[model samples]
Target: MQWQNVAINKMIEEAILEADKKGTKVVSLGLMNQGEELNIYGGLYVSRHPKLKVKIVDGSSLVVALVLNTIPKGTTQVLLRGKLNKVAYAIAFKLCQQGIKVATMHEDDYVKLKKSFNSSEANLVVALNFTQTVWLVGEGLTEEEEMKAPKGTLFIPYSQFPPKKYRKDCSYHYTPSMVAPNSVENLHSCEDWLPRRVMSAWRIAGIVHSLEAWNEHECGYTMHNIDMVWNATLQHGFQPLNLPNHTVIT
Candidate 1:
């Protein structure tokens, strides 16, 4: 009955996994409303290795940890479900500490994001002017610039606040043809091809084997989906047109 929410959550999780495989660090971020709701969504954080442990905490603690980039020695990641502003600041501060590059977005867009998240009116102005960060979520869609969020700003996509269905003609611009529909049909074994658009690096071993069996007559399907450049990363990598880190809030 509530399949949409499931799909959305799966999308975000898949993105994190795919991004992680590509060696891109991700961190989950969000703002918890009175009912503990998130506005910006979340992401995965990368560290020095694959099997690193992470810390999960309330929004405030996340901010402190991210701002300092000081997790306990065994921690490699952080997950937060809290206020949008605080989480954003933590992400920005931590990125700065690690010397990681970020992306920038248009100014008007930033203003709108601040207002939507109910961020401090005064701080909104200062944050907009002082930071060049990308507003990751907006109106059930992610800003294009979020793909490479800049330093000093939040990167949660608008879609994270109220997860929306993708449209073929209007709000979103992707076409079915953009994704190999036949390839999708052939991936029935996975029972969830839609998530692959964003989460490409994950192998889904058993499902992949099934796909291989189904395509035994053909020889190049894997290469088509694995070697070619799809969005920003290789076919086997996560390059979602919508920033992969954006959460699909429930």
Candidate 2:
């Protein structure tokens, strides 16, 4: 649908009003609707409707949590590519805290991402090449840039949208998602692009928020505690996906 952004926002505002009227506890923003470019991560709605009873959540923290857990084992370093959004910064910060190197391709990006960390944090330096096998990517990836990866390099996306698959030698993962436990009634089919029974972290975050009864909005520059959201998701029986050994396309 070629819906104009203003019309989309109007529809969203209408839904928020409807949900609030029905005593809905929380309303999570879907993919593009929560973008920094769209509605300031859903903040614009909250600012417009200040007296709303339903809390607005962007689910960014859980999105970051899922991306962090998705990184493969034994990775000492990973490349950070694409636009640096809210989730990108959080991932870089957590990885640096865990002593993992977050490599950048440009000095300008390095300078900008470096300011996010302190001297105590691990490396966030400019890498002249794609030496690391794991790449953490977000928006703004191009097909031309995708061709530069070494064979078998894994692309894990934190963006709401997935990147195009142009390199068959390289592997692409589904956007941040997890397996909903069997107890989740009637979850027999895939949720969007995810495999069967797997759910988007963004959707799961709203379920967790309501279960926890959190009254705060997680939109705009605000983020829920990553550890808290992850633990709560696990406590509520969501499990991380165990990727197959050979993930590369044939």
Candidate 3:
């Protein structure tokens, strides 16, 4: 993985430059391209090419929007477990602001998230009870952890991929995504693990970004208005999907 870093970065840089040359308005970064460790979600390219015309979007805001909205209605509390990212942080903060309690399974994560809160010590608390049936899951979730969850627990993933189906009793949700509208023609193939006509939130974010003609670059740690992006996506006919937990749904 480390060996391919330089080559991949070079390829990405070249592609960005090529997009600029062709007058492409925006280029959206996919899941792995975020490069949380190597680059700050495509910030390296922006830093290297200050005058680059093509805007870059990591699609974090839209992803956050999808995750937040996809959360089961009436959920007052949720278990947040996974490797924390920009979107995770944003989701936690927004959840706190909305008065929804976010319980962290790890002490390190709890302390870090608490420090992120700054002054007000509210919402984020230790996970003593897996009483909450809904778990906001992401990468680094293991089979052992899945086993700890109560029976019939819904593991809703907010990442690029879904969790392994280790527990037959516990349901694993499809990655946060939206169903493409009937107007979307020429979509013969399904995207990744999503069902037919369902598009990843990342790709749909770019579509909304272009539709809105947003001038600001959405790359790096910068976040656009989550509600605004969600509303615009809906206005453009992108429908929120009832994510599949048991199996893929067409």
- Using lDDT, give the best candidate's number: 2
Backbone collisions counted per model? 23, 0, 0
- In candidate 2 the C-alpha lDDT for residue 163 amounts to 85
lDDT of predicted model 2: 0.85
lDDT of 3 at 226: 92
Among residues 3 or more apart in sequence or in different chains, the pairs in candidate 2 whose N, CA or C atoms overlap within 3 Å are: none
Off by over 4 Å in 2: 1-3, 117-122, 188-190, 244-246
Determine the backbone clash count of candidate 3.
0
Candidate 1 matches the true fold with a TM-score of 0.23
RMSD of each: 16.7, 2.5, 2.3
Per-candidate TM-scores read 0.23, 0.90, 0.94
- Give lDDT: candidate 3, residue 120: 74
Model 3, 67-110: lDDT tens digits are 89878889999999998988888899999999999999889999
Candidate order by TM-score, decreasing, is 3, 2, 1
Q: Give the whole-model CA lDDT for all candidates, comma-separated.
A: 0.29, 0.85, 0.84
